[model samples]
Target: MGRMSDEPARWTRATVYPDMWVDPADDPRDGASPDGELATLLDFLSGYRMTLRMKCEGLDAEQLARRSVPPSTMSLLGLLRHLAEAERDWFNWISDDDPLPKLYGERDGDFDGAVGEQAAVDAAYADLEREQAATDAALAEHPDLGERLRKDGIAVRELMVHRIEEYARHCGHADLLRECIDGRVGQ
Candidate 1:
């Protein structure tokens, strides 16, 4: 018989990747050996990005847009939208001071737009791609990872680290949300 509880245990041993990390001890931020702190940060961000992608793979638009949890506006699609905005907000706005307007519109709930629809899913992914490319370009132009950016008079490196932290947290959310949606989870 199925449990009567609404709160389901979403994760299982079979669903999670057992050996995803190459070497936990080997820090990605090891100094001066070609791959510097910036490279390490980028690599870490890319890893989470790929993880998010894998978590959503094979899911249809409706599934991707499902909220999975009650009282939260955090669908996989919403996360994609949020991340794209975050990338642009930090790299394009704070770092480069780009004047480009925000994507996905200006409504407070714009990220939640077209929820459970194929068009929304496609738009979220496309926004992510565009924002990611812009972030890479901005990073490429900067080159000096050590150079500090003063955003609203705050240090830019601090903001960048915060951005990385934000993605890592959201990826964790995606892990659980994806598992809840379809019992598929890993990496």
Candidate 2:
């Protein structure tokens, strides 16, 4: 057999000009140095959401919905839809407001029904933005992280951390998927 190739066993993120997301110093989301726990948590959550949005930026509908990975229904469009639903669900859980009816009734419907169409892509982004704004507004009404409002009695701190974790996890997925789509990687 021929000698093995000299490439590293694990891949490192590329830092080429086209692959560069933005200069670390130039990144606008670095303003997370808040003075309190709630501010810090909200800043991190918003940063991750912005990261996901950056991953989806500049892609067309078909690219956004491209199920480029086989056997995984995790297109960027689907992620947008899923996050929208998640925000809505959590907002309802933590507040006394009436939530909009389920966007996708089935468990995986958000990802499953994510068709590669401009309208669907637009709707998903719009829903995610609207739901996230509403959730933030609802959350702002409660000043204490320990406050419990919903039936499950989940504390605001727990709920906020969960939201941050959820977005962070999906952002990892989004980074990989975006790289697979166009060989673009970022810091």
Which digits, one per residue and each the tens of the lDDT, describe model 1 over residues 9-73? 44433423433321334423333533677767776777678767867777898888888657777
Residue 57 alpha-carbon offset, candidate 1, angstroms: 0.5
Q: Per-candidate RMSD vs. true structure?
A: 4.9, 4.5
C-alpha local distance difference test of each model: 0.70, 0.83
Candidate 1 achieves a global lDDT of 0.70
- Look at candidate 1 and tell me the lDDT of residue 113: 73
Q: Quick one: best lDDT, which candidate?
A: 2
Clashes of 1: 0
Which parts of model 2 are misplaced by more than 4 Å? 1-20, 97-99
